[model samples]
Target: MKRREIVEKKKAISEIIKAASAPEKDHLCLFSQFRHYQYKGHSFYLKSGRGDKLSSILKHHIQNILKINMEKVYGSEWPSEEKSKRKEMVSPEARYIFIYETANSDPNQMSESVGGRGSQTVCANDTETIVGFVHFRFTLEEEVPVLYVYELQLEPHVQGKGLGNFLMQLIELIACENRMSAVVLTVQKENLLAMNFYLSKLRYTISSISPSRVNQLTGPEKSYEILCKVFGVEAKAVLEVIFSIANSAY
Candidate 1:
């Protein structure tokens, strides 16, 4: 072929390659700025780093995003007995506990529900400033363990913005990537809004429902529903949505 024709053909191939790769390039650029971690109803960003550093940042964001008051949640004076009890529950590899205190409740009183031996009080972004928090517990039901969300809280200010859904989706993704069956959690029947959100909106199915177990929270045990969503169904849908959002951002 003539030299001029050869040059023209090469230029045409280069253009084709660029056109073929443009969409993927765009996708990467879109999601480049933010690192996302899904919780029940919120997508947490951790500025990307080593696992320990990312965990700390995630803990802080979770607490601040929910706007929880730590002092009020734990109370002015630390209950020594409760602290001692929690220390006992902490094992070598227990997941950390995150809390976003909405009401002024004693940490000692919360011990039964929130604190235990396997929990870590993760660092928050700041002191005396609160939004909400989530507590996580790790368990090995099978060969590959799963991280369970024991408690999730969001202050009044942060509620109603669909953060709960975002957090759940994030957690589901984490569970799926780890090859866990699903993220499991129990919610009180009395909390109708939460129940409705989980059942109706999130599409979580009730694996089991217990009627007010003896050591349950003060209210009429009502019913405690253990909800779960398999990785194939809900988790896949969530990842699609995240990609969609990232694409749309640009």
Candidate 2:
């Protein structure tokens, strides 16, 4: 499809998301751009992962970004082996959001690069530079169908700038659309930034099923917490106390 059509589609998606977002979450939509982001000197478009090449690159990034935390929690070289075993992660089955920088334009042809939002068929396999990704799956988390964010990693340059918030809002929107119960993910306890980002920044609460809440003291600690944001009243009611309800609100 033409670039114009893709832009219009993304705008429609963005507006749908904006309308679905609650009043408290309106802050995440402060920026006009949703899939496209303006960085140091690049207009990065958010794309989808496809094919072996994009899958390989996605694994490279997952290992590259999380290697440090993996070593700290799971031992050195853990990510190297894990990444290969999990290549299916970037497959079409899972929802993968990729951010890429627009390559230098043909000066003779097009002078200034146009606004870069993700087109309907924006494939990382054919993109210029893959900067980051947010991969998620719709799955049963503690028996409730939830949008489980498997991985979110950005290049050092793209870490800030409200891109993460925008993507998370997208996650919630996806959950609402698919009738998912909530948004959920696991974060390494050692990764303070991730823990804080989900807990403090995004307002996700420690899941009742999280290892930390399950076995407070001597539980075989995998050093991670499952965090979540629930949608339905019944799900939240059940999840709100799944950890503390039976345990006296520990």
Candidate 3:
């Protein structure tokens, strides 16, 4: 986005944040707070990096859940002697995390009954068992402020659920509310499953800075792709202009 448009959008989003009834809506789960966005019957809780306790849990998840996926993409030699490179990647000290929770619901009870949602019946301490997490931070890409997704890791048990898409929608909502022009992330070319999930399911496009786009000759050898979803009128217009210039140069 142009500088002027960015300023205006930030101002608008700031207004929305201020105008909202509360900072975040309460979820049925006991301990989550900050921001909540529900989609397709799933409740995703987002919170800024909290304490070292949360950080430890995040690292544990990355070690057990994300390491395999990373090895699949980056090559088999990626693991450390300890079997996890998470010491470097999953940094809850900086970015916020979007948490997918586990609610041990009893099938015996009707969801519609007075007992209500299973989440209400069970006291869920999110730190102990996190189904999945997405780490993201606000950043500038081509002069446009965006939410950059560092990682989106889910436990195998939670993999097939619609929670992934729901979490992304929640991220987009966050970017839209923060006055960001888009949501962006890096995906390894070798990780076809993730590439298809973002490109086909989420409708994100290969960004101009993606190794594939910036330098095609060397691009094919690069491991990752930068993908983005541009939003708002002004942001889209700016991207079109950037693409036109880039295409002409090529």
The numbered model that scores best in TM-score is 2
Which lDDT tens digits does candidate 3 get at residues 1-250? 6999979876765554343212232222233223343444544444444223345665676566666556656665565523443543543332545454534233233122133222322224655655566766666676666777878887766677776786787778767766678888988776778888988788787787777777879986887888888986655644323552222111
Q: How close is candidate 1 to the true structure, as a TM-score?
A: 0.44
- TM-score for each prediction? 0.44, 0.67, 0.66
Q: Of 2 and 3, which scores higher on lDDT?
A: 2
Model 3 CA lDDT for position 180: 73
Question: Going through the candidates in order, what is the number of backbone clashes in each?
Answer: 29, 0, 0
Largest lDDT belongs to which candidate?
A: 2
Judge candidate 2 against the unseen true structure and give its global Cα lDDT, from 0 to 1. 0.61
Ranking by lDDT: 2, 3, 1
> Candidate 3's C-alpha lDDT?
0.59
For model 1, state the Cα shift of residue 214 in Å: 16
Instruction: Report lDDT per candidate.
Output: 0.43, 0.61, 0.59
Q: Which lDDT tens digits does candidate 2 get at residues 43-100? A: 6665544323355545666556655334565565466756653665645445566666
Off by over 4 Å in 2: 1-33, 39-41, 50-74, 77-92, 103-128, 241-250
Which digits, one per residue and each the tens of the lDDT, describe model 1 over residues 15-62?
A: 543442232121112222222333444433311111132344454565
Error of 1 at 162 (Å): 2.0
